[model samples]
Target: MCGKPTARPGRGRPPVYCSRSCQARAYRRRRQPLPAPGSPPAPRPTDVRARQRRRIAEAVWRIAAEQGLDAASMRRIAAEARVSLRVVQYHFDSKHALMVDALRLLHEENERLAQGRIPYDMTEPGALLRAVLDEFLPLDEQRAFALRVFTAYYARSLTDPVLAEVFLAAEQPLERLVADIIGVGEAAGSTAPGIDRVHEADLLVSGAVGLGLDVLHGRRSLADVRTVLEYHLGRIFPDAIPTSRPNPA
Candidate 1:
């Protein structure tokens, strides 16, 4: 394991040891039998279950996005996933249960993508806030598909109490996060003075989502949405410069 430099070989055989001590150590290691590693770790029941659940949820996402929420029936989901109906039932007991699980998984996936794009220790809270807002745009197919399905779920939530509960559960926490970021920027003197953090955050966050939905439905171009947000964000931070950093993933 010592990474010391070794003597060069004379073009015939390779030399691995630079000195007698290393040679001795290598020899001893070669002679001594290593303990058997046994077998690779088996998949835990929970892990297998989670994986199965994820596959089913992704099927739901695709079907919901391409067709509609009403089309994502339990049997259709099973067929889309190429699994038996019983297997789908085993993983998700009912269509309502499946829809909830799929929505949660979608949020987890969206968070994972944003986390990957934004560094955890990004120093500038303003930059962090900007990135978070930018993520709502449908800059690429993956996000566009996600937003499409999410909009369908949102419409369904209007009549479905269960779905509305899921949406509300996530919305408050997200608004609080955006507000916290704005609070940090305000403390750093980067944001406009005398602004209410929670109020500003609510407007910015909801506005971004509203813009995204419009863009998703072809009512407004993505560029137009960007321009509008830029104007608003510039007003909030007059001293800050705006950059069009499109994440086309």
Candidate 2:
């Protein structure tokens, strides 16, 4: 007998398989013998749950950015992901959990971008700062969408303790990285003396966040934001030699 349990009675013969597919699979297996012990195992199937979760998270981010965080409900996310509502619920217990997961995904993406862009050598602090800060700028459609979602989530975190904890935890690594860069520059004599490394890092990060919001809201163009960021970097690393500025177009 097939192992799967049968459904409740429906005034018909009791079912031996859950469905036609299962019945056919059992028949095929019965007709074939198992492979030899030394034979290589079958390849593992792709992880559907992980794939579904990622799909759902990406959908949530797009909806949050385009329509605001409040619009990113489980039902809406399911619709956007082209999955059933039940599938979304199966992946996440609630909307809050989905949001937290989506935020984590966004943070991971930001970290990837930062790691890829930041130079291995920290001797050039001005260039290093520019590279690090550029990761947060909304210079393209993808970055702009990410910024919008991050800002929306951050604003929500102000009133939600759980989100606040998650957000603050995610921020720690970037702050530490910035501080370390500043320290390295100071050691190399490329940064201004007597600078409060931690405070400067905080200010730099806060400035980037503000500038990203401004660009998202069209308060300033990306080029203008880049110029402002360059000016701020100059102030922080006054001793560092200036590099040729890029054309702001």
Candidate 3:
């Protein structure tokens, strides 16, 4: 006599397949396609990290944007990612480490967006200046959020020396890049006559920070920031005037 089929353990439903043999028999009956041997196995998607890290980063940014940096704590971030807090902590050693990573990610994203769009040749004048302006202006949602998070961290850093050190270190590359661009514009005769490269770089960084703060505080809308940048660009690098040499007078 054949053995009777038993009900499944959890839901109390009859087993679809009585045993391993039954499963194999059913599967064999269903035709399945097999790929050609040398066809590279469908290339196995290259975006695994992109999917995971992007999800994590999106959650981090969303938390940062909506709740501010403190709200982006490990547990909060993990909850946002729908993962265990330990998982978030495992990936990043601490809140400071995570913040550093977030900032670095934001920096990379901005660089990617600004690359090639910014001209390499300073001799071109307006084009190079526009590139510098483009980086400072938060023209869209992504840029806006990045700048917002950056500004938050920057503010937090004022009292936290560790955070400040990290923030300033991250900003050094950008400052250097700005200095180089200013130097080029000055050399190319595209900047204002009396503009000091170091001084101007300082002013531009301050202005960018101010613009970001204004947008963050509702003092100015994103569109207003854009307009302000346009106005400043025109004043800073007027097409009619030649770049002025530093005067001894």
Per-residue lDDT of candidate 2, residues 1-249 (tens digit):
457676968698877877554665566568667778999975443476578789999999989888889998778999999998766776676789889989998888877876876786766767887778887888667788888888889889999998898888998877788888888888887777678889989988988978878877888888888878888778778865554756544
Over 103-156, each residue of candidate 3 has an lDDT whose tens digit, in order, gives: 667767767877746767756655565566656656557767887777767778
For each candidate, the alpha-carbon lDDT, in order, equals 0.81, 0.81, 0.66
Candidate 2 lDDT score at position 36: 83
lDDT by residue (tens digit), candidate 1, 94-205: 6798999899889889888987987544357766777788788888788899898888899899999998988778667778887887777777788887788888888998
The positional error of residue 96 in candidate 1, measured at the CA in angstroms, is 1.2
Residue runs of model 3 more than 4 Å from their true location after superposition: 1-54, 221-228, 240-249
Scored by lDDT, model 2 comes in at 0.81
Cα RMSD (Å) between model 1 and the true structure? 18.5
Residue pairs whose backbone atoms clash in candidate 3: 193-244
Ranking by TM-score: 1, 2, 3
Off by over 4 Å in 2: 1-46, 239-249
Clashes of each: 0, 0, 1
- Candidate 1 global TM-score: 0.78
